[model samples]
Target: MNGMLPWAISFALIAVALAMIFAAIRLLRGPAAEDRVLALDTLYVNGMILVLTLGIQFGSRFYFDIALLIALFGFVGSAAMAKFLLRGEVIEP
Candidate 1:
């Protein structure tokens, strides 16, 4: 079971990477700003998943912290971008 952990994480990371590539293509080819933003959000989610897989592969808690930070930043950035796209500004005052 212990030996299988790394292999499982490796497979998950590979899957996430592939998904990220597809998301990148979507980001590049999206016809609308909102579509591009949605693709970018998906990319962020894949990145967080990759980080988690890395943490599992390496048996490190540090990567978990980094993943948490990435998730937090991703959420905040996506929200700001969406707000800016909808209202033309992130903040009114």
Candidate 2:
């Protein structure tokens, strides 16, 4: 089982990369603003997952930290974009 671990991790990383590619295509070609926003949100989530998977594969604490930062910034960015879409501005006076 141990011998299969690296292959599994490689497969997972490739799958996530493919997913990210699809998400990027959607982000670029979305028909509407909402669709694009959703795609962007998905892209960030996949990025975080990819980073976490790398951390697990490599046994690196640094990748985990980077993944955490990705999640945090992604959430905040999504929230701000949503607010801007709804109100035309992210911050309220």
Candidate 3:
């Protein structure tokens, strides 16, 4: 298990990077605002996963903290965008 850890991490990083790239393409080529928003959300999620995988590879707590921040901000941003799409406003007036 230990011997395969590095290979696993490398694979995860590559997979997440590919996912991020695909999400970016969708964000740019999406025909609708909702598709763009969903792509953006996917990009952030992949980013967070990439960071967590790096944390595992390096055995650093700092990466975990950064991943947590990414998850928190990504969730909030996605929620705000969804709310705005549904009601035309992120905050109630």
Candidate 4:
């Protein structure tokens, strides 16, 4: 029973890693600005999930903090990019 959890986490980690790779490729190769932005968002989410699972697998609270930071930064970056795309700028005067 104890062995299955680790195996599951390992599999999930690998899956998330693969997702991140694909998202990176999309970000680099996407032809449109919106596509690139979407890819960037996906990449950040996959990374955050990966870190969270790693934290669980390793039983450490430090990774949790890292995951939280990732979430915060990723959301802000994505929002800024979207705003720039929509309004030609990220900040308003």
TM-score of 4: 0.95
Q: For model 4, which pairs clash? A: none
Model 4 lDDT, residue 77, Cα = 98
* Candidate with maximal lDDT: 4
Go through the candidates in order and give the C-alpha RMSD of each one to the true structure: 1.4, 1.2, 1.5, 1.0
Q: On residues 59-78, what C-alpha lDDT tens digit does candidate 2 reach at each position?
A: 98999889889989999998
lDDT of 1 by residue, 5-49 (tens): 677777898899999999999999999999999999999999999
Q: lDDT tens digits, residues 1-93, model 4?
A: 569999999999999999999999999999999999999999998999999999999999999999899999999999999999999999999
Top TM-score prediction, candidate number: 4
Provide the overall lDDT of each model, using Cα atoms, as 2-decimal numbers: 0.93, 0.92, 0.93, 0.95
Q: Which residue pairs of candidate 1 clash? A: none
Model 4 segments more than 4 A misplaced: none
TM-score of 3: 0.94
Worst 10 residues of 1 by lDDT: 1-10
Residue range with the least summed lDDT across 10 consecutive positions in model 2: 1-10
Q: Rank the candidates by lDDT, best first.
A: 4, 3, 1, 2
TM-score of candidate 2 to 2 decimals = 0.93
